[model samples]
Target chain A: MKNFMALISGILFSLGLGLSGMMDPKKVLGFLDVTRTWDPSLAFVMGGALVITVVTFRFILKRKAPVCEQNFALPTAKDITSRLVIGSALFGIGWGLAGLCPGPAIANIFTGNVQMILFVAIMVVSMIITEKLVD
Target chain B: MTISSEFTPLLSLSGGIVIGLATTLFLLFLGKIAGISGIVRGLLTGKKQDRSWRSFFIGGMVLGGLLISFLKPELTAKVYEFDTFKLIAAALFVGVGTTLGSGCTSGHGICGLSRFSKRSIVATITFMAFGMLTVFVMGA
Candidate 1:
């Protein structure tokens, strides 16, 4: 049941990506390139998502446990470390260059775009290497 | 760089709301973050019991892409083209960076920010700044 729900959630999330124009790399670039060709659509996307979550998460988390899990697997770390800063900076550069993030990339796998296939393949390998090498 | 004439407000907001709704569903029932990078990493390296749901969720994403291709072919079509070197460079940065940073756009940008985690707030701001800077530098 949990897995089924996950599948449904994934589908819904990808649909949102599609409908919001996030599936387009150019669109994403347009937003990221604030100095030039700025598009405010992505901001709206985050705002819309936040409006629902900022309120809903507070209430949902007040519960003892979620329906399918014994506990919420939330992040506990609070310190702002250099690792976070440097890594995020790198990720941002990548996002700016390609305008594709993990979610949108994965969501578009079945589109048979050779470039996307190459991107995901390299990303997976890079992630594996990073996991092995990094603490 | 020229100003893009394409600015979508209503569609983007509606889509974002739908994305938020999906995350809510995950939180309400599965107690998951609906974070694509984390889910992919977990599927690659997490415990055996955790793999099933992650795989299903990823499968659903592929299925969702396929469905969108049929329903909205224009949305599924590729818009920008990148060279091999740039693509690999970008992918490498994204993969390693997400791993080290512990989240991606979905996890840190959406889920973490909504919860108002200081770590997430810092991460999001850092990435956004750097992203804009990169575009500025590269003139892309």
Candidate 2:
């Protein structure tokens, strides 16, 4: 049941990406391109997402415990450390250059976009390399 | 036809509503948080017990996009444009960064921060900062 739900959610997210023009690298790039033909559409998307999150999470957390699980696994660490900064910088760089983040990148698969496939492949390899290096 | 000025906002609201509904439904039905980072992590970790939920979560995201596209063909046009090399490089960088950060934007920015997580706050700030800096450097 959990797996099924997760899969469903992923599909929904991908569908949303496709529908919103997020799967198209050009759209993403346009959003990032503040100087030329800047598209603030992504901001609206983020804003919409933020509003939903604010309202729903407020109620969900009040339940004392999650419905299907014992408790929400929250991250405990808190510090403006080097790892956080470096990691974020890397992620940002990737976003600016590629114009596709992880969520939309995966979602792009449905579009049969060859560039997205190549990007995903490189991402996977990078993940492996990073894991090994850090280990 | 020229792009509707209202299209982005409308799509964003609708998308948000769908995501909210989906997250709520998943939590109520499956007892889970709709954190993509956690789902992807579980999928990769090979925890048999965790696999099913992770798969479902991922599937839902994909299905959501497909369903929307089918219903709204006009909205399915590609938005962003980038070279293949740049995209691949960016993907690789993000993969490394997410792994190091221990979570993605969805996990930290969306879910974590909502729960008043300090870690997430820090993560979000860092993510935004880096994002800004990257764009500045890339001149995109």
Candidate 3:
């Protein structure tokens, strides 16, 4: 049941990403290019997502555990370490350069674009390398 | 440097609502944060017991764009105009950064901030500011 839910959620999320133009690298870069011609549409997407999340999350979190699980597997780390800031800064740089993030890049797999494939492959390898190093 | 007037606020809002709904479902039912970076990380470093659901979730994401393209046909477009080397370099940074940062835009920007985690708030601001700076510096 939980697996099904995860699958469903992933699909819905990706579908939203596609429909909202989040999957478009140009749109993403445009949004980030605030000093230049900017696309404010993605802000509405973030705002819309944030509002729903803020409303629903607190209520769901109040329940101790999720509906189908023994515990809520939430992110618990809360330190403002250099790793967090440096890593984020790096991610932002990459995002600005390529306008590709994990979700959109993953969804772009269906495009059959060799460039997307290469990008995703490299991204995965980098994740693994970082995971090992961090551990 | 001009403001773009091609704002699709309604479309973007509906899309965001869908994303929030999907993420909320994952949190409420699966007890997982529907973060793409974390999910991808899990796939790379899999615990046998947690593998199936993760795979299913990833598979769904891969198909999501395909499904939408199938339905709309006209909405299909590719904006990855970067050169081969640049794309690869960016991917490396994104992967490492997300892992070390412990979250990406969706994880921190959407889910983390929603949960009001101070760490995420800091990370989101840092990334966005740096991202803007990078674009400005590179003139991209």
Candidate 4:
């Protein structure tokens, strides 16, 4: 049951990425391009998502715990440390340059976008490299 | 609402609804948060017991695209440009950053903060702040 739900959820998420124009790198780049050819559509996507999430989460939290999970696996740390700052900086830089985040990048695969594949390849390779270095 | 553009509000609304439904269903049926970060992390770390969730989660993401493609072939085929070197660098950096932060935007920003997690709050703020700054520096 858990696996089935996970599969369905991923499909839904990818569909959202497709419909929201997030799967298109040009649309994402347009959002980044504030001065020229600036597209505010991505903002709508974000706003729409925020609206749904805010309302839905409110109802969800009313429950003592989640229906399927034993408990919510919440984060426990709360420090504005150097690691946090540096990591965010890196993520922002990547998003700005590639116009693709992990979620969208993966979704782009269905489009058979060559650039997305390249991006995903690098993303996976980078993940491997970083893991080795950190260990 | 009279639709003016190919990208209609209804498309977004329905898309969001699908996303919300998927997330809720995953939580209720899978006993898991629909967080890409956790799934990917577990897969990479060789958490054998956790592989099922990760595989199913990723499979769902891919399948979602396929389904959408069937409905809107034209929209799915839109072209976009890419710079290989920059993208590679960016992915590497994000990989490193996510590792250090112990979560990505989905995990920390979405799921964690939704639960009023202090760590997620800090991580999400950090993510946004740096994203703003990066855009500023890159002149994007």
> Best candidate per DockQ, number?
1
Tell me what fraction of the real C-alpha contacts between chains A and B each candidate also makes: 0.78, 0.55, 0.78, 0.49
Indicate whether candidate 1 or candidate 4 has the larger DockQ.
1
Model 4: lDDT of residue B34: 65
Each candidate's TM vs. the true structure?
0.96, 0.83, 0.95, 0.82
- C-alpha RMSD between model 1 and the true structure: 1.3
lDDT at B2 for candidate 3? Answer: 31
Number of the top-ranking candidate, with lDDT as the measure = 1
Off by over 4 Å in 4: A62-65, B1-10, B73-78, B132-140
Docking class of 4: acceptable
At residue A51, what lDDT does model 4 achieve? 64
Residues A23-128 of candidate 2: C-alpha lDDT, one tens digit per residue: 6555555666655556777666556666777777777767777656777655567776778667766776787776667777666556544666677677766766
Name the candidate that leads on TM-score: 1
Over A28-135, each residue of candidate 4 has an lDDT whose tens digit, in order, gives 555656555556666555455556666667677666676657775544566767876676667766767666667777766656567667776777666666667776
lDDT of 2 by residue, B22-69 (tens): 666555556565666456655775468877777667666656655654
State the lDDT of candidate 3 residue by residue for B4-29, as single tens digits.
Answer: 43667898899999999989998999
On a 0 to 100 scale, what is the lDDT of residue B123 in model 3?
93
- For model 4 chain B, give the 10-residue run with minimal summed lDDT: B1-10
* Per-prediction TM-score, chain B alone: 0.92, 0.78, 0.89, 0.78
